[model samples]
Target: MSRRSSKIEFVGSQGVPLVARLDLPEGTPWAYAVFAPCFTCGKDWLAAARICRGLAERGIAVLSVDFTGIGESGGDFADSTFSSDVDDLVRAADHLRENFAAPSLLIGHSLGGAAVLAAAHRIPETAAVATIGAPAEPEHVVHTFGGRREEIERNGEAEVSLGGRVLHIRREFLDDISAQPQAERIRRLRHALLVLHSPSDETVGVENAQRILDAAGHPKSFVAIDGADHLLTDRADARYVATLLAAWAGRYARGSVPAGPA
Candidate 1:
């Protein structure tokens, strides 16, 4: 079935308007999901757009959001922290609950993936959680800061190049990531988990995925994306992830009887 896409605006953690895209199926959807984009990436990122489209085509309405200070969202990237990102996810889920349906599934890409893992407990309605190229801990993203860490530490903030765009990096952002209790959250997560990572991904190593799986409880499964990159830049790879995720989530998110992996 074909899908419809619409632009949406919702208040974020900091009470600023955050822009998003809602992809809906042609008919009533079996479930609703929230998709969080990669670090420093927006809702319209190629992978996010394609995955939302793919899920919508399979009868799931997907809402992909731009976190505060990124994409069309209103806020300063330098003022946001990893904890705020998790709060933003909660706000996004609240928006969904008020307007349409509560999100039964939460999907995140890269750092966004880690955010979902941390935020899942706050959204009691979430039945399934999925991560693509997510790190085991929030601090894993510090590697991207590279040489700028010293500069940010010494000067409070620094403008660094990320994905060809310059963004402000703050010492508070680094401290927040380092202080997150992500592992503790994962150990107690009540929702089912699906971890998708590419074995060859050069960005967030595959070992991160292993650590996440190890920390999560039962009803969790892992899928290696094989030849995909960290971003799942290839349209085919992104679509494959969406398709598999939709199917896997069906067992939990669709209000059907839960079934263990074969």
Candidate 2:
């Protein structure tokens, strides 16, 4: 079936307009999903776009969003925190619920993954959650900041290069990531989980996936992407992820109940 893609704009946690792309399958969708891209990676990233396209081809409509301060979204990157990212996820869900259908599946990449885990409990309609190259703790993202940590601490903010793009890193951002109780959130996550990570991923080690899997309860599963990098830059890798995700999500993405109250 041919898929259709459309641009969308919605208010984010900071009251700033967030830009997103909605990929819809031919005819009515069986389910709706939200995709949170990797840190500093926009909704238009190659991997994110391909994954959404893949899911849409399989009958699921997907909303791929650019969080505040990234891509086409309006906001200051330095001013945004992990907490706000989670809030943005909730806002995205609310937008879907109001205009289409509540998202039954939540998928995130890298730091975005951690955000979904923390936000899942708030979205009562979410029945399945998936993470790719996600860190077990939000603070784990600091490693990418390198020496800029000291500069941000001393100056309150510092411009750091990430994925070849310069971004303002702030002490508040560090504090927020550190303060997030991700382990606790994972333990209490009521949705079915699918954790995908590459053993060769240099950015986020495979150990992080193990920790997340350990913290999560039943109905959770993990897949090793093997030779794929953290970003799943290869088209094949991204498509494989989408295919497996659609299959796994089939069991839980519609009306699946939580094991218990979140």
Candidate 3:
């Protein structure tokens, strides 16, 4: 159950270099996965790091990355949009396909869950998509903009405080997220879907998970996180999620792909 994690860099859809970490099992991985952390969160956040490492121990190699302008990546945060996040996720998959092996599982947390769902169709090799605390709509994250939504819409951009950091919010970012046909996207997803939500999550209500389930077709599943928070601050909560995710996603990916370096 030993693991090794290494740094990786890839060109995002916007042409900026994005930073990522690849967590690999001691031997050949049964399947490879892409992990997208929550909104405004980076790849190395405690929750994300724990999940990737735990999943790797469970035999799924994981590539977790920071989106354009976020974390250690190079770009202007104000310029990144919801659509761009989806494009970047596809770019991450492309990087995997060309360098190692194509990812068969896509895992996302919070708003990232929505991004993976939007990007799933572009990754034909992906067999399963699992979302943790995801919102049913991309625009659900706009609440963080608070009263600045009007200011940004009026002035084109405004700096707002999110997760204790001041990030610029642009009108384009707002328009792009709001324009997403999330319900249509969910209904059209071709891969198996798994939705995980915490009933007590204060950030994104559990109702969002139910909405995604309702929109998806058969082969969809849901799990309640019980007492966990949206960010899964507790080590046990994060590990439990990783274990369950690996168990579920393995069923869909292992049979479709050969075990090898990933």
Candidate 4:
């Protein structure tokens, strides 16, 4: 495994010890970014780590973390809800603010994208938001939890499968998913936005990207990530995302900052 440059342990609002990796360009001052992974995925997931490292190699410091109940974080997956996920993101941003500099960018994949969209309003330090293969609606995730929903509600917990892995789903978690439409929340975001999606993405069809684009305000851009899947499994696809992100972000108003590291 390729080790990340900086590994940090931080506690979420729920007291979960979230694990994260930070990559920074030498001498880069203050500029920072935060990455949120998709549902049932962790910081070490293939394309995510590659993209994070690529962004970090550039002047921007990048942080990618495992949410409260996932990966190396200290919590049970069954007990986690979308609200908790947002809380975790806020905690990570706060960590960057208190220890390093405020994060200027928010990058999210799939469900992570929705979580970032929901968190953007609260994180005043974020100048821009980006999403790749994101579902416009939060309930879309429930399709993956089928057959287990009733059991979860009845038994208080149920073991469900996702991304070729089994996880526990709890009733409270389901209730959280039922609370609101993620697309509506995203439409209210005030920050500059970027939406990237591949027409070939089998997991999250391109339609979701269109919905997000339609809902967001101006200063938003859309790019088709040709030949990429929901996971961006191929190295070339992941690199493409990194390259496009660096270029697009460079055009942002904050792009005026002097070149740092690459």
lDDT of each: 0.91, 0.91, 0.92, 0.83
Tell me the deviation in Å of residue 136 in model 2: 0.3
**How many residue pairs clash in model 1?**
0
When 1 and 4 are scored with TM-score, the better candidate is 1
Which 10 residues in a row give candidate 4 its minimum summed lDDT? 253-262
Task: Give the RMSD in angstroms, all C-alphas superposed, for model 4.
Answer: 2.6
Candidate 4 residue spans exceeding 4 A from truth = 1-4, 253-262
In angstroms, the error of model 1 at 94 is 0.4
Q: Name the better of 1 and 4 by lDDT.
A: 1
lDDT score of model 2? 0.91
Worst 10 residues of 3 by lDDT: 253-262
Q: Give per-residue CA lDDT, model 1, range 96-168, as digits (tens).
A: 8899889989999999999999989999899999999999998988889899999999999999999999999
- How many clashes in each candidate? 0, 0, 0, 0
- Which candidate ranks first by lDDT, i.e. highest? 3
Measured on C-alpha atoms, candidate 1 has an lDDT of 0.91
Cα misplacement distance, residue 59 of candidate 3 (Å): 0.6
* TM-score (C-alpha, index-matched) for candidate 3: 0.97
In candidate 1, residue 11 scores what lDDT? 88
Write the residue-wise lDDT of candidate 2 on 162-219 in tens digits: 9999999888998888899899999999889999999999999999999999999989
In model 3, state the lDDT of residue 163. Answer: 90
Candidate 2 displacement at residue 244 in angstroms:
0.3
Top-down lDDT ranking? 3, 1, 2, 4
